[model samples]
Target: MIQKLRQSGTLLGFVLILLFFALKLPDTFLTARNLINISQQLSMLAVVAATMTIVMVMNDFDLSVGSMASLSGIVAAMIFTAGYPVWVGLSAGLLVGVLGGLFNGFLVSVVGILPFVATLGTLTVFSGMAFLLSDGKTIFGRDIPTSFSGFARSGIEIGDIKIPMLTITAGLVIFICWCILEHTNFGRRLYAIGGNKEASHLAGIKVVRLRLIAFSLTGLGAAGAGLMYAARVASANPTQGSGLMLDAIAAVFLGMTMSRRGEPKVIYTLVGVLILGVLDNGMTQLRVDSYVREILVGLIVLAAVSVSSLSKRRQS
Candidate 1:
């Protein structure tokens, strides 16, 4: 049992957390409506978290994702309001993310800036751009077309089960990330770089390029998330994505002990986000204070990081 737990602790932890919430909030939490709500609410965050996970596993962090999402969503919505096609707006949003990632990568990989400082600086700048684009206002209504909102509003309805489009899109994003990380040489290089950059460099891997792609994907992920948010709310706001940074990062840390040990994976990251969603849902249903719930989340992040670090050391 101990050995098995060691092998798959993150999965076990997620299951236990889910069960705790279900038991505590029995009627309200375990119902289909609540479950659907949780999926819808977390779908955007999950997409952004997936992006952050790729950057993070490269032994780097991109603090700008939250702001990137804001900027991209605002840009896309602005384009839609201006009468451009939805695809055009969507493309513009994704472009913002890719470009943002490249800039971060350039700063860190080429300019030799530390990932922490570089992304932090960009985070501020990106956030400012978001505010500037929206002119510090929320966007909505007739200016925004129903077709654009349909992305968030549409869903597949089977006899008893309905899956929101946003949820399905998030699922597809997770699948793509898994394929990139697990099935490709690109993913292998990223894991290698994370494990040891110097060793990877000595082994002749293009560390810089891989890092660039990771950061780029992070931006793209953020942009994709932004689009999702816009569709859901039928509007965009500078403050729209402000609250996601911590939750997304915390989710990644909370899944650090996945089967890959020190390395995080898509499935593990999804579990991490789900745990957070479940926690927040159960607490809200139980009428837990917002401040208290946030504190609990912080504590969980700390605990997960500490345990993952200790496990890595023991394994080494």
Candidate 2:
């Protein structure tokens, strides 16, 4: 019973947040259209959070996600601006993500550098690359192909609500990640490694290979999010994804609080994403200042991590 309540507490908090907003802005927040709008807005963050969960599950971190995303979008947008096919640009962006992730993994698993230091260095490198690729300007207007920009804008309509393609794509990515983390042998190995890396290595688990793969997936997700963001706005800026890494990490940490083992889960991460999304939307409607919103979110993240640590101590 205690465990159940603990697990449900985050969900309850989410419900309370929703109810609070609904009561305060009954004409807007409680409406289905507004709820769907929130989902659409959070779609890109959700994609990043999905893979971030996997990275955290392995007890690893990827601070370079935001920079990698910016680089990917710049790469794709530049290609489109130069009159290349959409597929060509997309392939180049994804390749950058994969190769970038591999570089981070290589530094951590092969060169014995810590994940934090390696990713921080790479984050700076990738951010610089993004500016270099885009010449420190936003790519917009007729330079971006209509076909490419239409990808995120197109969607299925159900009555009054139109489900965005970006949201659907995010959902699919989240489902795939959930399956990989919850139902696959690879996932089991990750948990084993996280629980005890030395024992996992003794048990013949390829720790280095798994870590590389985990980081690769994270990069891929970040790249995909970048592409979607670029598509949604029909433009790509060097700093467009500069804030994604912090938000994604915060969502993962918040979700970890809901886990019985204090580990990250994709579904819970989605809930965390929703909580942040709703908070942003609600506060915006209530005319809260942006700086105040940031401070509140930071406080919430700190509280969530403290709660998670306290729960793990109790279990131990």
Candidate 3:
């Protein structure tokens, strides 16, 4: 009973929070349109959080995710500005993410730097690089091809229902991450490494290679988010992705506590992301102080981390 309750707590809270908001603002909060918008808003965070799970599984942080997203957006925007095909620009952005992750991998796996320190350095570098690319200005959507912007906003639409590209992208990434984590040897090795690095190494696991791949996926995921953001707003700014880093990381930890073993899982992370999105929408309707979002998110992170640590200690 205790285990079941514990596992379901986060999800239960999710539903209750929605109910509270719906009760408080019947017309605004309970509307299907509002709910869909909230989901769309958190889609980018979901993508980043999905990959963040992989990094956490190997016991690492990708602080550079925010900047990585910014860099990816800048890359795509610049390509469009130069009149290149939007596909080319997007592909370039994804490649940049991979390269950035590989570099981080080299630093940690080859140069033996701590994951936090390595990603922090890259975060600063990527942030600066983004500004340098755009001259610290927003790359306006009007400057990009109409087709690009249109496709960004285009998705399946059926009468009163619409599914956004960003949502689809996030779903695809989450599905892929879940498959890789749950069904592959690579995923099993990640769990083994996170559970016991020395033992995995002793057992002949290529801990370095596997971890490098994990970090690389973080970069790729961040890039996907950046592209979505840039497309949605039809603009790219160096600072666009900064605030999302903590949120994505927070959701990843939140997800860890949703499982019996405190393992990082994608579905739980989506729930965490949805919690944030719903809170933001609900609070906005209530005219709450914008700062409250930060406070509540901080509290959520703190609680999630504490729960995860406790779960791990009990399991041990």
Candidate 4:
């Protein structure tokens, strides 16, 4: 029973949080409309968190994800404002993210730089590039096509529930990430490498190549998220994804609690994202101050890390 609780604590916490909010905000929290709104708001974060799981499973981190996301969005927005096709802008944004990911992977895997340091440096570089691209301004207004802006605003209806397209898009991305990490041989090798890098290398795993791919995936996820945000709001800004890095990290750490071995997993990360989403949405409904909300979130993250640490210690 104790072991089971340890493994399922995050899910339990999520349920309890739901109950608390439902009771406190009886008039608003349980409404189908508000529930859908929460899903829409968290969709982008979920995608980033899901991909972050892949990077974390290989015992690597990508601090530049947020900055890469911001830059990617700006790249797409600039192209859009330049009267380019929507697909062209989207592709350019995605390409920027991929290239940035490759650069980070090369620095860490080939140049032997630490993951933290490499991504951190790239974070600054990407953020600067975003600012340069937009001249530190937001991209919006008449220049953005209805098709592009409509991307975020569109959705499908199911009986009484309206599901935003963003939610569906995020779901597809999460599902794909889950399949890659849970079903593929590549994912198995990543876990092996994370477990013991030297041993995996001795066992003939191409550690560097795999790591490069993982980081690139991370970049791709971040960029995908950025584009979603831009489409939803019908605008892009240099600082749009500034907070994504910490939020994604927190979500992943919260998710590690769901793993018996305290390793990150895609499904667990989605749960973590949901938890963060719940907390944010609940607090907002209660009119909680933004700074206080940040403080509480930080504490929750610290607690999650502590739980994961304890789990790893017991395993060892």
Off by over 4 Å in 2: none
Candidate 2 per-residue C-alpha lDDT over 1-316 given as tens digits, one digit per residue, 9 for 90 to 100 = 6566667777887898888888999899988878778888999999999988887887889999999999999999999888899999999998888888888888887887888999999999999999998899999999889898998888899997889888899999999999999999998888888888899999999999998898888889989888888898899999998889999999988898898787788999999998899999999999999999989878877876776576666766
lDDT values of the candidates? 0.86, 0.88, 0.86, 0.90
Instruction: Kindly list the per-residue Cα lDDT of model 3 for residues 77-126, writing each as its tens digit.
Output: 99989988888998999999999988888888878899999999999999
Encode model 1's per-residue lDDT on 286-306: one tens digit a residue.
Answer: 889999999987787677666
Cα lDDT for residue 120, model 4? 92
TM-score of every model?
Answer: 0.94, 0.96, 0.94, 0.96
The parts of candidate 1 lying over 4 Å away from their true place are: 1-7, 311-316
- Misplaced by over 4 Å in model 4 are 311-316
Q: Give candidate 3 misplaced runs (Cα > 4 Å).
A: 307-316
lDDT by residue for model 4 (1-316), tens: 5556667766887898899999999999989999889999999899889988888998999999998889999999999889899999999999998899889889999999999999999999999999998999998998778898898999999997889999999999999999999899999999998899899999999999999999999999999999998888889999999888889999998998888777889999998999899899999999999999989888877776676566556655
lDDT of 4: 0.90
Whole-model alpha-carbon lDDT for candidate 3:
0.86
Assess the local accuracy of residue 177 in candidate 1 as a C-alpha lDDT between 0 and 100: 93
On lDDT, the candidate that comes out on top is: 4
Higher-TM-score candidate among 3 and 4?
A: 4
